[model samples]
Target chain A: MLFSRPMIPIDILVYGIGLAGVAAQAAAGVLEAGRKPFDLFGVVIVALAAALGGGSLRDLLLDRTVFWIADQSYLITALTAGLVTFALVRFVRLPGKLFLLPDAVGLALFTVSGTQAALALGAPWLVASLMGVVTGVFGGIVRDVLCNEVPLVFSGELYATASWAGALLLIAMKASGATPGTSALAAGVLVLVIRLGAMRFGWRLPVFSARL
Target chain B: MLFSRPMIPIDILVYGIGLAGVAAQAAAGVLEAGRKPFDLFGVVIVALAAALGGGSLRDLLLDRTVFWIADQSYLITALTAGLVTFALVRFVRLPGKLFLLPDAVGLALFTVSGTQAALALGAPWLVASLMGVVTGVFGGIVRDVLCNEVPLVFSGELYATASWAGALLLIAMKASGATPGTSALAAGVLVLVIRLGAMRFGWRLPVFSARL
Candidate 1:
């Protein structure tokens, strides 16, 4: 490919991110409400809250039907994941260190998804990009709220910043006309790299305001 | 004069609610932050989050720049109240009980406001009415999340329903050509009466599901 053109299609990258986000939401839901069993409605509520909270907020802001509501598969997958988690918790015990990896993966992917959605909606690049960051991080914020923890976005790990960086990269790739897959790869790599780098180097965004 | 129409105005009720909500958020902020010396940013954040969380969410869901953001007065009042609470908490031995009174007041008022906004936006009466209930109660829900407590909305109380009933009253009045002010007053009184009645008598709503 010539330097003027790009590698890896943006569409493929976006598709990967979409699938990853769904999987991540399902897994997190399992972890959250799976420990306890309630009625079908209760279990589904928790699963959907964990999976769709951030996106629903985003769409509500944009005034659209929740994406998952339109795509029944996402809801079904989340329900199945939660039920399986509730049933299988006794058999599966992962190390605490490994537990958050799936969530992190989903966060990274969701950032890209949000950005893409924003761009498609014709929002200015910055707002679109920030919306992406919000999309990636806020579901967990709601999850934590429901779980009674100060949002992880507030305390540590260059999470929001990393999500923004990934979104920004994807946007740039879009501007440059990189293939959809290539762009998505660039975005995903951008997020994972920044996050891992921040963790390894103990990087922290200065707490500008104590309000959080 | 006649009992043919619902009594009380929602606008007056909302005004009272907005005022009370501002106070509750300020006090709750101090409590949530562990009685720390919150700078202006800290107190304002707490106050605004508590005061505006519900209304903003309702408006955004309705696609509007939260009333607080649109009008600086609400912001000023909320921040000022927060600052006052921060300063006063250090010297006065105010019992937490005082907070309940204002929170109750705010909740009743906001429920009407939410319901009215929804109706004005031309939503179905049912949706509009529910919106009012959401507006009235979502702030407390957010506050609970911030404070690391289970949401009062899901707990045993007639909180949202009181607001809903009042909202429905407002919508009904408006649909039948009642002036906005008159409709507001009736709605507000209805909310106040129901909420006050519930609190005074230890009223609770049926919980469809139990916490496991």
Candidate 2:
């Protein structure tokens, strides 16, 4: 009964958005992997991790069947996107920032979906918000980790913060009796705008190094 | 019926070994975190990840309840061990290699437990064997990744290889009708001996740099 939601039009739209988000993350993963001298297997592994790691963690924590495993479309989409990006990059000198916009879009979509999923499960407010942040940013963290680099989210400009803000807004809107569609749309837009604005304005969190 | 096994003496012994493995990984995590200038929270996070990451992943893949959440004893044990190591190291400069023996023991214990769990769930042979290796080494991988270093299991002296070898041996023994306890004991010893021997003899896998 966990995933027995009636597939209304809004649900279909959300599903499409989720697939797009997966594709975006997988493409970004391939780009990141290209920076290192990894083999084909390594590249695919990184791509899969980047695309599926966040949602998998969220589902596992919530004891839900993993989304990709429940529906293989997500897996196929990630793999196809990754392979295409890998092949494209080998031939063309694409700009490093080409993925920035799509990445932001993916972040917004994932945040909305993740928060909604947690709330639907009747999770506590704080846990729901954190799950949203995790789904929005953990993929990038996993990608960076696999590449043996510091997780970009931990030190980057307003990425997870943007996701968290939107998650909170989504919860607030829902509590204030907004329709689910309206709340989801508003929250997703907020996340996207904040992420894009942060990049454009070079906003950053304070970097602290504790001596202890 | 998943975890409905009778709590026989062997099960209790295995559970005790599992707890010891968790503690060992947690202590090793603290030692690694000491190298970085992380605060108390960061140290604890790293400790928990190193102690629980592997088993969590295995359980998630198999759709089983996460061990730490199902039993709080594992969480308490990891936290206590991490804090104790943290406190001890502040007063006394422990040798850098102090945790090696415990880490090896942990790898053996985790490999045996993980393989057994997966096989009980009726996972195919290859999947079950890989689950064992995942449980044996993924913690170290997560720890090194959080520290922004290449995974020690991927680059170090025959760590995951030893784990995989032991996992395969476990499966073969079980298939040949060996007693469960005997198979577990042999496999655990094999992993420990191979890991220790690799460390002492400087055994290593080929380090390849592919141009593609």
Lowest lDDT sum, 10 consecutive residues, model 2 chain A, at A1-10
Task: Name the lDDT of candidate 1.
Answer: 0.68
TM-score of model 2 (CA atoms): 0.60
CAPRI band for model 1? incorrect
Interface DockQ of each model: 0.09, 0.11
**Which structure among the candidates has the greatest lDDT?**
2
Specify the highest-DockQ model's number. Answer: 2
Q: Retained native contacts per candidate, as fractions?
A: 0.11, 0.13
lDDT of each: 0.68, 0.83
- The C-alpha RMSD in Å for every predicted model, in order, reads 9.9, 7.0
Residue B120's C-alpha lDDT in candidate 2? 84
